[model samples]
Target chain A: MTVAADQPTALIRLGRFLRDNPVIPLILLLFVLIGVLEYMRPGIVNERWIGNTIKFAIPLAMLAACQTITMLTGGIDLSVGVVATVSAFVVSSLTPLLGAPSAVTISLAAAVLVGLVNGFGVGICRVHPLIMTLGTGLIATGCLQVYQRFVIATGSEIPSFLEWLGTGRTFSLPNALFLFLPFAALILWGLARTGFGRLLYAIGANENAAKLSGVRSWQVFLALYTLSALIAGITGLLYVGMIRAPSLSLANPLLLPSVAAAVIGGTSIFGGRGGYSGTIVGALILTVLGTLLTLLQMPEGARRLLFGLIILAVTALYVRFTDQS
Target chain B: MTGFLKKHGWTLGLLAILLTLLIAIRVVQPNFGASGLESLARAALPFAFATAAMAVVVIAGGIDLSVASMMAVTGVTAAVLMDNATEGQAVFAVIAVLLVGIAMGAINGALIVLTKVPDIVVTLAMLFVWEGVALLILSTPGGGAADWLRSIIAGPVSLPFLPEAWTFWLPNAFIFMAVAIAVIWLPLRRSKLGLSIYAIGSDDTAAFRSGIAIGRTRVAAYAVAGLFCALGGLSLTMGTGIGEPVPGPYLMASVAAVVLGGVVLGGGRGGLLGPIIAVFILRAIRLLLTLMAVDPNVTTIVEGTIMVVVVMLGAILMMRERRS
Candidate 1:
């Protein structure tokens, strides 16, 4: 029996390329999907549609970035959505009293605090990431609901600056697109080029080995979770900006889909492998998928079904590829 | 006694905590008598069954996020089927629902085993799929369970000789739990396959080297989990007396119940009893908050805080045990 490795044929080379450059295939998939959508709906080819797609995709992309970093470390943050909501809620509440700058500062600080708590639980206390984050998320949400129900019956206002950032346009392009480009680049470079990124991959790939090699695993986890929480908070702020109002329901729906987006982008949920580059594309794919479903006049049920199938298929492909190597 | 206590110390501690909470509730609402208890039992049944379903999969070292979605699928199926059927066909309809649940679970098991996908990811994706499927089957919830099924599941059964006020005058939910533990958990826990499930959970490589079929065991565990999820779905149907389109927040709630029960998420560390006890404890917490005039939000906040505190305490206990 001849081994494929011994003589690399065209098929083998193509397979190797697909395996090595997962982002390539992901980008291809995105373009192909866009092209199909464009053909189906001519309006999809316009700048307005492009702006709308990017506008909707921004929050998911930001949330996916958080999920990517945490997942790369072999943990997940289910609390990202709630943390974001709490932080945004805090920002909204404070804006009336503290003004825009201070409220934003306080909002980001609130997010950092949530992240720190998550990190402490997962790291110092040795709770599972899922449980720790989940517990914290629940507590935060419960607090929010209580505040809304009893403490404050009325809603808070969104700062104009945030609204502009969230829904503003520059040169006929969504401002969010500009914001995402740099954010994506920073993360993509950090994951691929920075020492912190290497440590993240090392921890995800093998925590014990990393720990033995002098990496303070707990510290790394603390930082990573904090960063994830901060990202979630920022996403919430951006989301509120886009809609020009705060919503309780915004975060819950984003939770599973953000996780889904990260996984779809080729990031391994188990950690170490995958990149933010793929995740950006993944967020785009999800947005396109939602649009396509709506355009097709399919109900939310069909969209969810397709979402599940896509996640399963992408995950299965990654699994198959990784297994062979 | 010391040795036995050391081995089962966590179990005893959990039981103690449960008792303390129950007593506290009774003290707060002294008038919450047997009927209150009955209502609590009825409310706890669906979640108890959910926790049991989770326990089976978690014990086998696999997590099934799809169980909530599975419950919805099965519930919708049962409701849709029975709503149109007469009294004679309700039994067959239920059988069909159970079979569908088992089949869905088997598929999850098969996908995990064959594709080598992580259990969390596979089940997470399936959660979406099943939920979507449920929605597709019944866009709007308009179906109902048969009268007999509801009465049997939610109604209390009288002990022929017992007074109506006696505590032993059991709700059918309690009977359901007893029969489930007897018919499903007890035999399964003692069986060769059950042992294999644990073996694989603890160390799949070792289990395989010892001649256990990893694939078969995992599939069986998931299949069994599916059966329990189907039961949970039925309980939901009976509780509501109708097919509800929205599954609400039971997915995370069930996972929370399992964790509160002290079942290790990565598997192989807990048993069936903890989850069952934990489910009741959770219900009591919700009930306690409601009784205390606490806002719904406050109740959830309190619940989350309690869960975190308990889990942290559990971790502390384990750490201490390790040190000693």
Candidate 2:
């Protein structure tokens, strides 16, 4: 349908404005925040710092896209961090078996299976999203640990392909960015262009109404959860390729970066509203903010407190200004 | 029997477990003896503080996953304050830590109440914030506590009367819990604010219509939870003899204990007594694994597995009741 034809009446005109205008303000906000930081310190936009910001943004970029996909259907996969962990371990284990190609396939397959199970458990069983995913995420990590300890062994793994994944780049861009091309294009097309994309927004907007209006409820649930898992799995596997192990293989605590990344990206926690496009922006903002703070040698724990405070503040503002309910 | 089972259910099951494990220990090491009763006091102490803290939030139908980080933050801050402060200043640091808990928690409550944001999300954000702070401050996994404080907390306290042999095996944390239970729990239970905490959790709109201040109650509930978390954090500070950034397991472990104590996650139900027992039972599992000399990795696996089973069991029980 034509853009004008698809536009809603006066009631929804404001929504369309929001959906369209959200990104510009966000990008501007980033610039403004950066400008202030730079003014205070001067030269944050220097070439080297810019380069570092891109590098910093890569991992979170992978995470945001993954998180955004699931969030589109109104769910958050707490397992993304663990998925990063499992992928790393699998890569380390598989490198010597049939080489990286086979290992990559195994990792992807595992992610698909996990995604399916997560989808089915959440969508069909109708378990609370947080608990279902948390339970499964725990089990996945435990099994990985079991495999790491007894089955495979856990230690330093600098698998050859992993180095390529983590460090490889073309000209100036990360090779990981290349991996996201298919995901970004597919997601943009699926969510914004295709019938299924419309279905997802519809489902997210109101699951009951969507179902009553002929949406295949369970199928939609299955699709969103699975898609969310697949994206996370890809990010995880790619991360392993980069780091040569799971993110958790290094054991940075599972606080709420991925979750916050999604939220800060402007994805609604209540569901039925969000875009991966904004998630990318949010992740970038976070990386820059983090790096800048790190430069001053601020205590790491202090940053977490700040991160939490910001989320609370942003959420409060969004609710007051936007929700008013 | 069922009535008794329902009332004393979580408590009975947990005590049975504690007895069986202690008996098992008696058989295994025989002289793994009464002197070791200190282990129970220390083991249960941190969770006792956390679970009580969590009870308030849960009473308002919210959860504070950040308690561990708060625990770590408090632990780290307490350690830092110990070195610089005069005795008087050290006392202020302790109070300061509790205030931080209350403040951190109040933020969660207010955010959830005002934005109608989910408790899970707000707490999740707080979780990150707290842990990140812990990471920067501690830097390393941990550092040692003040000598005087550790000695008093870890050392035995003698009572006056019959003999030194008749003394209770009370750790400082256990004593703290006793004082907190009296100061925090007793009046809280009988307060109008306390009853309203349950009311809001059970049904916010209904509570509001009945003239309860839903928003304020929720905020107060989470704030109060913060206070308990600070105490729990203090216990962690005491038990570990210092601050360590690795409070993740303790946090989740307390959650499992809270769940076991028959305090359902959805709130407006369950009691502090339930979580206390669950925490003790969970600690016994770790203790059992220690006695078995099972790998720490294996212990982690068991902890996660047990958590899933218990949660699933609770869900199943709920569904069964709903179906019937």
Candidate 3:
């Protein structure tokens, strides 16, 4: 009788825990999806598969970091994809001539320059983030094309360190975790604990109010975009290492998916809410879904159609559930 | 004069820029003639229509990233239906294609309303969905258009009773553009739905409090945008005489045109006329770049730079005006 009475309290406690942490449901959903994938193809969810999934998902999650941080300020960085491509292309082409370290440094610097321009446009000039980033992205693409002409004669080389981090495995676990874990922990900690991070939320929630409270919103924007672009540059390096190829459009395909991941992870596009923890789960979910689609052997068109449908469905359901309790 | 300038300064500024570009083209290519203008008009039809579509939705405080995909889908649908068809059948095919576009747009509107998803996310999803559908319709970039339909859209106007000088420089596409403006834009501008769109975009809560049907008006705005996209697709079909599954450079170009045209991105402050003119300006810039024999890669840089400069100028102007 005492055990039966305690069971009701435990059930209530679990329910309260889930309600307090919405990310729990998403986590549960991720596991459910993995189970479905395993059931579909018996023994497919092995250590190797897990490593590959994490390997591919890292670049995407890193790119999504740009979106999540920007979206927190009620803005977006549409140029992140191009930034990644530029970084990857530049680093690869320069590695042959400048050595890997300096090439990586210069490529990251280029990304910072682009980010500075974006920040100036959005923060100082008061241009909308979408237009500012789009214009900057276009300019970057154009610059890349011109740069390509000069670099066409030179061969590209992926940096050895990046390659190891991107593709190497340690005890059946991805080596990328060495990089990602620290990066994610820093972001999570920074966002939750730092005054600068709180400023982002304040500015996103209401710029005027934040300004009234002496937030210096423009400075925040400047730093935020610069940091976001730097992250994108890092993602590019890792992506090139993983794919072992660099092209003008290397990271373009991940652009929309990154945004979707952030949105699915419960970051409000309008801003003022959400955390990096949810976005990490979101990235994992998309990677698993991609694997499932590939295993289904569907045509490209059907694959895209289903991908869109599932994102829509998942976002809708996620929103519905979260909104209620 | 100051009052007049204050009222129409933006339009006048745009016109001056356009004239400068045209003059520059004339100076660069001494042989630039009526035929060159005609060809430019023909080339610009698709962009103008597409920009108009973007502008309308943007004015309603939403962005549809799928406009280019919608154009591709509708264009391919038209191509498949009108291939080898007679004149009457081609007309039917045209109407059906437009309906298809409107239907697709309505679905977008309904989904956004029902799901409470942000406009950008829903449209972003639809961008892939529609592109996928386009691929399914034409696995490759190959589909035919009716001969008469092509001639009507892209052919030169040749009125037998008119003077050769008057008729030779006119493109049939220009007439279609004028008809579309007359039939769609002007009426929509003066309609209640149009006012509601502006109202909602400017302030949805206030609009809701004022008893405006936000959902229906938003749907109508999207549907109108879809119709314009259909027109753009039809222009593409006529210009190319075939269906192309890929959207090409039109998507970014359309958005750039909208922003450059002085329409505020958050909506409710711009007009279609500005964007239409902006399209010609963009085309003229391209033509000038080509005439100057600049590297094609550099042309994109120039275009993007010009976009940034123009918007920056607009921002500065607004700031000054506000201060004064």
* Best model number under lDDT: 3
TM-score of each: 0.96, 0.84, 0.95
User: For each candidate, what's the DockQ?
Assistant: 0.79, 0.40, 0.65
lDDT of model 3 at position B1 = 100
Residue-by-residue lDDT tens digits, candidate 3, A1-325: 3463568666556555644675887898889989999999999989899888888888889999999999999998999999999999999999999999899999999999999998988888888888888899989999999999999999989889988987889998888889899999989999999998899899989999999988888799899999999999998888888888899999988999999889888888888888888899899999998888888988777777788888888777766555643
**Candidate 1 global TM-score:** 0.96
The sequence of per-residue lDDT tens digits that candidate 2 reaches over residues B156-233 is 556676476655555455555677767987798789998998888788888999999888998999888878877777
Q: Give lDDT tens digits, candidate 1, residues B1-324.
A: 999897677678778877888788889999766667778888888788778888889889888988888888888889999987898899999999999989989989998998787888888888998899889888887688998888875656667687866634477778877687669988988999999999988889999999999999999999998998888888888888777655657677777878888788787778888778888888888998898888878888888988888888777777897999
True contacts kept of 1: 0.76
The CA lDDT at A144 in model 2 is: 81
Q: Give the lDDT of residue A125 in candidate 1.
A: 79
RMSD of 3: 3.5
Which 10-residue span in candidate 1 chain B carries the lowest summed lDDT? B164-173
lDDT of 2 at A38: 88
Please give, for residues A1-325, the per-residue lDDT of candidate 2 as tens digits. 2464465464256445655556665687678768867877876677666655665576677667666766666766776667666766676676676577877778777767767766776676665566556666766776786677653443445466557756776666666666666767777777788887788778767888998899887787787777766666666666666654444454223225667767777777657777877777777778767765666666766766676777766655544434531
| Candidate 3, B1-324: lDDT as tens digits | 999887667777778898999899999999997778878888889899889989988998988888998999899999888877887898899999999888888888777878888889888888888888888888777777888777875656888999988886687887778678669989888989889989878888898999999998888888888888888888899888889877767778999999888888888888888888888898889899999998887888999998987887787778787999
After superposition, the stretches of candidate 2 with alpha carbons farther than 4 Å from their true spots are: A1-16, A34-52, A72-74, A112-127, A150-165, A192-226, A244-248, A251-255, A296-302, B7-11, B14-30, B84-93, B111-118, B128-175, B243-248
In DockQ, how does model 2 score against the reference complex?
A: 0.40
* Clashes (candidate 3): 0
